[model samples]
Target: MFGKTFAGSPRRQRFLGNRREVQPRLEAAKMMDRLTLLPAELLDPKYGVMSSPLLPTLASKFSNLLVDPWESQAALSVLLAYYGLSCVSTIGLRQEPTFGNEKLITTPIAFDFSHNDHRMAQYLMWGHVLKAVDALVDLLQQLDYLGDPALGKMWDRSLIYVATDFGRDKTRPAKAESWGTGHSLNNGTLIVSPLLKGNRVFGGIEPTTCETYGFDGSTGDSTPGLNCSEGHIYSAIAQALDIEFPERIDMSALLA
Candidate 1:
């Protein structure tokens, strides 16, 4: 949840020759417009801005001011560009007919489960998370949740999940530009979401993946890799949203 996200202006350089203070002052003024623009009664600033009656209060009113209107109509262009690079492929899974009406209201999103190359040239950790968020947000908005209050209410119940294989390397990768940034089975998984249930982190990552536990039961084949994280995360999300997982699964052990 970012307050105000601004992409740089393309024509900003043309104004570079102007007073150095002009640009910063203008930007600040625009931001102020956005902040004071919210249609709500302002609470005492002491109580905090969020306490105000602003609709969609969590979203920034200034978000619209981002991006150069001449170059692009999109907000957060720079952040989105950074996001575009780290992402490899986005595979959206339509609700399978096999699930029938059981999945009538739910959508499944599965990303590339392949291990991220630690040696890659550029990788933005937050970018990966944002991509997933963008996808989920797109799915929700497409379903018309943004327009329908009831639909949006139901979406408030939905959960967003982030499942990764082990933890980031404590040392950073060993090769040239690699940095010792490899995998670390040392810490636990990080699960972040605005959904209430997603607030808690889970599991324990030991030196051996074998010791890291995710599921509730002893599924003999459960291995502490990306598979395990995905399974548990899915199960928790399914439980949260009152959706059922597909039966006869390869990842059932992880969901146990």
Candidate 2:
């Protein structure tokens, strides 16, 4: 089994490939037309790294270089991926191109959990959990930035999330001087903001006994065998994304 589930912060629902392939070419052409608009140095540093103007210069110097702008961008993708920068294309979500170039942007979903160990104890030590939440908030902020009159629209709709395989205890296990205190099904929290109607805590927690109870957190408050679980939190996320499934009440909107 997958242990447990919780509200996911900065959840990912996109990826990269062909959509990115066609983007840089159109984007490159756009850059060529705006030659007199502004100097390359004036461009944002991140975007400045790629200079369409130098394609001819580099081509003459290194004949092995691929001349197609998109192909060159693909090479850049390989380089970025090698450095742990994740790349994803929104093409799959939109199904049709509405923007000028249909370009792809890169982003990462970071959590407090350790990549080597999925244990809650290790996760608590990693401060990036809250940092990851901040990153998610920044992502929404960027979306709003593009919506400003100056930058224009970024994405029509964006739904962000924070989730985990299982719920974690607010109390640390080391502080409790106990083992296997992780994977708590009792109660976990999720934070959803601006993208949704409201940002409030959701889900409920059933009382849980210590590890002596065969690692079960059930206080006998619910149906047989169901104990405290993350299913309810995941259900709320699905609903926020407008995802519907025929099942029991996973999350009953305790907060308006």
Candidate 3:
């Protein structure tokens, strides 16, 4: 694991708005300790030297050639399983198409020449999502080949969540060629795992206004008056992991 540390002064000033009144909560601090930092170099298949001795050295043999953009995720998954690690996080895997001597062409669904164009952005967003799923499936296939029952079981219990900053405006520009829109409060989250209790939506969106409404966490029933918050989302994750907390969360309806 990477042993990187950050100074409080810089992080607090830049990220926390230098707010002296705000302090870290005990629960948050404990959660931070559970995080394991993986080396960024592992993303490049060529640099296979792992810092953890518990990991197998054969990881160095994997090729990092950019035949596919999502190959990095598959490589990371192999190393994670070899080391018996539970979770991994990735960033910046989604990028716009590049054109040059070495071409990495990602065909856009629609071309638009505008500073705030949404067509190209939406195409790239879904493209990356699909590629990420493909990579996960590839990793699962490799784990099955290992013939290790325990590793296969761990894969069965694994979950993947993809979160974005915010939702885009429900309406697009009236123009035909180039289009853009502002951000909106209505957004949806994706949870991919076999451990979920049921395949049903816990919230609803108003057709006329394109606004989101909360739902009953205990019954999975619509709760138009109650809005979902960040705390509720975190509570759901804690419940999924079987972590006990004093907070009264209606996770009975959220998880199995």
Candidate 4:
């Protein structure tokens, strides 16, 4: 729904003003409030701020915030994604069987981190991650999770996943802050939902070598010598959400 998210914002007299050195910063301010396919009212930060205890007054606060280009677009996508579901679920409840059943069930509000180097990765972590956090927080609150008679209990059906490619080389020198680190096998993924088996880790990571290990798919036992592939994770989440798959699956280690 956004245009050219990866492209750098160009300079203009109205956006750039006199601070040529801060071209990107000033230009981002102009584009921050740009319109999208989502309704203009839904993008308003004040949606539930006054009535909801979980919401912070953020309407004017986002006006001049110069976020990463991709994140800037993803931030709005987050709202659209959540609200898209909210609209469908609301209308679906009132519609006859096939009338409102044609819409997408949901789509992840996805974004990429430019991990060219440690510094760039850190920038995205600070910029992109925080934006997503805020957007999600707003989503949970704006709909008044289980507070509205119409939308209550929606929380159990929702999930927020924070996934990464892999961890950085744990062996990187402590002083080598600027040195880009290589990918290490060990990493963590965060999934939030009441639907998931809470407070459980499916696999283990070796401390000394930073190597990751697998677990029994049938039973949630850690097997340090064995390794889990990405497929195991896929099966785990798919099973947790009751999503359909064609193959045999028994990764009960990740389900509730």
Prediction 2 TM-score vs. true: 0.36
> lDDT per prediction?
0.37, 0.37, 0.55, 0.51
Name the candidate that leads on TM-score.
Answer: 3
Backbone clash pairs for candidate 2 read 4-165, 7-162, 7-163, 8-161, 8-162, 8-163, 9-161, 9-162, 9-163, 10-161
Worst 10 residues of 1 by lDDT: 66-75
Which residue pairs does candidate 1 place in steric collision? 172-179, 172-180, 172-181, 173-179, 173-180, 173-181
- Model 2 misses residue 114 by how many Å? 9.2
Q: Tens digit of lDDT per residue, candidate 4, span 124-157?
A: 3445455555555555544544345576644556
Name the TM-score of candidate 3.
0.59
Estimate, for each residue in 35-86, the C-alpha lDDT of model 1 and write its tens digit: 3323445545563343212224223422222221211111222222222222
Q: Which stretches of candidate 4 lie over 4 Å from their true place?
A: 1-75, 82-131, 144-148, 151-153, 171-181
Steric overlap count per candidate: 6, 10, 0, 1
lDDT of candidate 3 over 1-256, digit per residue (tens)? 2213454556545655534433455233342222222444544556442343312222333233234444445555555654445355463343445333365434333222233355666676566566656556445544542346655644565566666666767654557574555666567777666556657778898776677888887788888757787767767777776778898586668776
Query: How many backbone clashes can be found in candidate 1?
Result: 6
Candidates 1 and 4 compared: the better one by TM-score is: 4
Show where candidate 2 strays beyond 4 Å: 1-126, 142-159, 167-187, 195-231, 245-256
